[model samples]
Target: MPSKKPELLVPLNGWKTLHNSSTVLDSADAFYFGLQTNFSMRARADNFPIKDLLKLIEMVHDRGKKCYLTTNILIYNTEMVELYQTIQLAHESGVDAIICHDLAAILIAKEVGIPFHVSTQANISNLLSAKFYQELGADRLILARELDLNDIKEIASKLDIPIETFVHGAMCTAVSGRCYLSAELMDFNPDFSANRGKCVQPCRRNYTLEFTGEENEKIDFEPYSGMFFNAKDLCMIGHISELIEAGISSFKVEGRMRDPEYIETTAKCYREAIDSYFNGTYSQKRVDEWLSRLSKVFNRGFHLGFYFSKPGSDDIERTIRGNQAKLRKIQIGKVTNYYPAASAVEVQLFQNHLEIGDTIIFENKNGFYHKQQVKSLQIEGESITNTKKMSTTQPIIVGIKVSKKIPNTAVIYKFIKKTTSKMKKKID
Candidate 1:
């Protein structure tokens, strides 16, 4: 029998990125999403409306894939009924599994006859705790993010259940995301708990230092000096081989509240890298290419956290400027049709404007990535040098030569034209 390919479990950020998930469904083995209830970690995300969520589960199951419902939030006494209702909904919706951080969710999963996976928030770092979960009938274990590769390998070797880990995206300073910094600050709201999915992210706040007294020992720290707790994002494309070797059954992506483009780009990159590594065609050039794709999204800056070694002070970024989204591409257009005989594509402008010589790419629904240059543009069959934003009635038509099979309704992204001062001076 052939060994199973490592699964890539991507996040469903919210309703806005739902369209983008189609691009990644083929690449991802499973998808985990949250709902509007307390059972989610991303209450800030759109999650899914009840009707849409049920439809989403059916859609995913129809594709012959698994869908995991995330109920990984801490449970309060008052919220028990609501939590169980969510679990029942997940069960009735035919979700393959439930990821839970709360004991209440685990008990409910058992009653609902659905399998459960312990969320990383459970802090299952050692073999004994893992055995405890397995004894509880847990189907999978998403071990804490703090476990190093050696520890993961050792644990996997000892356990029968599959092991999952966060391979890319953000990391939390607190172990297993047990954080209280948000609720303690900013007027101390009783309802805003990061564990419960309403985090204000006080860690991303900046700080500074100041002098407060006559004595030399009276030097005081300034307010808003730097992001002391702001951790860098994790990128493990370079370590794909080691992770697969560690017997990790799943490599999870961490962003669910980010832009859809970010979701599509990151998933596609990792999917290709994993396929290449296992097929014996892995190369440094390919690794570098995937890294470049990761940079196109918002990051807290990139690092391989606790995965390889003990994190030092260097792992945590202490800068005033936080890493937001860097790779911001505009949705300049979309393909309405393709003409093979002419070796061209028909795209309607959606946002921004594109010139004839601009660099852009055509992203298909199946996550196919293709780069092409704008060779021609026409409106009403008349030639034009450039195209601007247009309405449905007067959208511009772009003809770019292509070789690959472009899927119907592919998104076209115009690469931002970055011109430096020196280059501008030369042009002037």
Candidate 2:
């Protein structure tokens, strides 16, 4: 058993960069920001410009993390040449690599002399497909999500190329990269194989089955349905050892549509697990702790998925409601401008009331929560008797003595909003 640790790859969509920077910066070893060309038929433009894509790449790189630009959509028309040019620009802008499912785009990437990764949409499910991609100059292969653990191990043993597997996130019931759910149901096409970037995910929608009488003809089903076919998210946090021993090179987290906090927390958990495994101290308890943090986000229920085998009825969840997706707390103040001579921190409050000796917490979008106690109050560069009188917009200084360093962006709040009554009541 060769004991090399696998790399952690986090996928970032355009929307993930907005609120998840704090999280993304802290969690991912590297990131793949997705789909610059419009994949949604409903989108007005043909493509998101390379300039916009570069800004995101720069943002991710600024955080000292590696970034890969995705041009992985199926191409259908010549206009997609513009999309190819955008990938070229991403190469020039110094992205770590380009991800593409279309062979034409892969050739373009090679022509541009940039590194490339084969997208799962390429549907590399077997050793032969993996070898073909590796021979094509692909640096990594995102294995098709449909493969079982046995299949993965078999391929791993047969191939020398680096293999990346989806360790956590949603699973598509459709054949890998072959979904027409969007085009059929939403009337929008993803345009990848057709060489377009737009996609409408009709598969995630709900549908009711209808049966007709008199010769067993089918009748009209319900107009609206819930997520009947969507599988629970693939969560392998508890199975780190199995994956590490499978000879996989990278573990991927999928959430191009998720917020940054979700990206950061999930990435961090896997990173820790992989490192722990390689360091010879991997513990199930630690893995479970990391998974519990992930459960706090908005997600479908968790399952082992096809990694174990075909998902059973018990593996799918129709409804997914957890983790209040909104920010429930605000940073009231930070312990700043502390003086060793004065023995107090000049705290600034953003929106909450606090008193001397009151306990306060600071949390970021990544869900890194810490607490500090108020030792004294200060305002207008002077010690004040009443700190609670400060307005919502005002930054009131508070004096606090604590062991941990208070982060500047740390939101100081007295309470985290009770997103779940059961959890909150239990805590209470």
Candidate 3:
């Protein structure tokens, strides 16, 4: 009998990600999204407006993929009514499940008859806690990042509920991303609460390490020698088989605030790796290819985090705090007009072009995104053959028509195709 393929649960930061990025939708088995409320973990992201969430859920269901709504914020009594309402709305919208951290969220999920997946923020690290959540009607538990593979296997063996582990993306310096650094660093502002989805991310800043034995005197230390707060990003692309063999039911990629390119690249890499393993064609060369793709997006650095054993000094990245600008991809153009009847948006080029047979993403400020190829183009009502490159300092404007209409507020991005280190096709 064949083993069950572990589900790929991905993050959709906002409406743009949900609308654009076909690569993510095509490869991912399930998706998790945040709403524009204190109930979400990423309040800073362009989270889904309540009005659009219903439409998003319907679209996700229509695509035959599971959708998980995120209400993982730290809940208080004042927010309980809002939380219940959100869960009720989610249930009505056909959200397959809801991932949450607080016990209030669990109770609400249970009350609403929505399957609850325990968030990693709850920090389940042992068999006892795993069993407790399972008994509380938890459908799955996203294990804490601190757990080693052996620890995960032990919990998986002891529990009936599924064990989900993060396979890619950034790691928090604090345990389970529940750091109080932001709240403490800032002057105790209520809105800066990390659990409430407004983390200032003081940890992701340059910190000057200092040691002072006496309070009256200032000790001299290297001025901002390195970003000690920054930990290296996690990449398990090379070790997908090890994770799968360890009995993990799901592998998650962390980055709701990240761009569609990151989502697409990570999804394709992992999908290829997992499929290759199941197809009996897994190879080190294939792993290298996936790794190459993973590096092309936003990441500080990549290393396997605490999976085999405890992470050593090699795993911590003190050189920088924010994502490393390596293997970088970014916005190249913006939409200046929308022709809905013709299914096109007028694009303004800043740095790149929309050429024939080239993939482009239309990310709307009005809360929608979609991927399309440049099939046709027009300049001042004149037909032009493909590519439109900007040679001057001013933005170049042109009409673009595709399979779908793009909003006027949307900005278009051309996928920066690199010619370096071309990957060979896999042999089955």
Candidate 4:
């Protein structure tokens, strides 16, 4: 392991992700989030409003964790006024640091008196490039995604500031995510620039080919036969020990548009892995378990990225078309009533049925999330084994005993393993 424990920097999109990620995983040392502005990379996400920065910062600080606001998008003269205001607000609201890509943002952060971490978009692939940013007063360097373990070690050893790198989530097929395919393909949309953070991922879509021979013979190709540009999602969990020992200062997860359950599971599993490494309990068996848990969440299959060597054809997940997630949260219904003293909730069925021994989670608009296994199911005053899956027009209310109180507005979802048995049925 490194001389100091590395920070697990999780992504935060909104209050819901923050509530789940912070509470479910104590291994999460800090959170990086984007605001509802074009200056952020995740403009399509449920980003927090600038007005709520103080409240968001306060919530994170109450849990004794640091917060980093992302102002890491390419800027233009039209966005200059808003960019300055955003950085100034971040500094005033006690954001620990601002993640920046453009030199203008770095200068603005310095002007606003906020610590800044150079974004991966800056493409600091070598020692000199890293040193260039460090000399410019960067508090940390989010190294280029193309670097290997050896390159990271060298930079981390020489740099006085912390070194951060992506440990999990989506990987861009381009070099350090500097591709213009999205911008070129989506030319009609003014905000489709990947540098501006509104990427319309045409690369991920399956493509087909057509050919015309010299004899004027036309040929058609099958759909999904060409996914040449699709890159597998990056997964470093199995190599967490190597990463911790690489002299890096922080490990960051790269999904800002993921669901709360996705955030919770990733944070919890990574925390377990990190803690196990330092506590002398890390092993192949534990790593296998963590890998299995991670596989249950949303992913496009996993690869070791460039940490080991250059990615080849095998690194591309060709078999799977889209999400390779094994687990799916099926909405059961919404909580219509709650009995606080008895620690029970009354749910009105909307889509699926619920039964004893089923795993369920309750979520509300205010970012409250509570998960529990159904120990008992009651209908009115009678106990039942299971309810039909929305069999009738009448509302079916089921009472479930919860460990804690849940809000009436909380929607219930059942975590179920995805099955391919229903795939052919839909097509047929």
Candidate with top TM-score is 4
Clashes (candidate 3)? 2
Per-model lDDT: 0.79, 0.67, 0.81, 0.85
Tell me each candidate's RMSD, in Å, in order: 6.4, 7.2, 5.9, 3.1
Query: What tens digits encode model 1's per-residue C-alpha lDDT throughout 1-428?
Result: 12667999988866545553467787787888887676788888867777777788877887788889899988889988988888888888899999997898999999989999999999999999999999899999999999999999999999989989999888888887989888777456756888878888878766555565666655655444566787888999998989998899999999888766677778898899889887888899999888877876767678898888977778777753444454446667788888877777777776778778876777654435565577776766677888776665666666665655677668888756333331221110
Name the lDDT value of residue 257 in candidate 2: 64
Alpha-carbon runs more than 4 Å astray in model 4 = 210-224, 339-343, 364-368, 392-395, 403-409, 421-428
Output the TM-score of candidate 3: 0.86
TM-score of each: 0.80, 0.71, 0.86, 0.91
Question: Residue-wise lDDT of candidate 4 within 158-215, one digit each (tens)?
Answer: 9899999999999999889887989888764658988888898777766665544444
What is the RMSD, in Å, between candidate 1 and the native fold over all Cα?
6.4
Off by over 4 Å in 3: 214-224, 325-333, 337-346, 350-359, 372-401, 415-428
What tens-digit string does per-residue lDDT give for candidate 3 at 239-282?
Answer: 88889888999999999999877887788888888889899988
By the lDDT metric, which is better: model 1 or model 2?
1
Tens digit of lDDT per residue, candidate 2, span 1-428?
A: 45677778886644424443565567667877654354321132222345576676677778887887767766667646786677677788888887778777788889889898888888888888889988888888889888888888888888767888889887777776467655665445344222243445445555665544455335544443455676777899989888878777888887766654566668778888877877777787787788777876645678897888788878755444333332343456554554566554456666657666765665554434555566666655666555565575665556665545444545556644434543321110
Candidates ranked by TM-score, best first? 4, 3, 1, 2
Q: Candidate 2 local accuracy as lDDT?
A: 0.67
Query: Model 3: how large is the Cα RMSD against the reference?
Result: 5.9
lDDT of 3 at 427: 18
Q: Residue 339: error of model 2 in Å?
A: 20
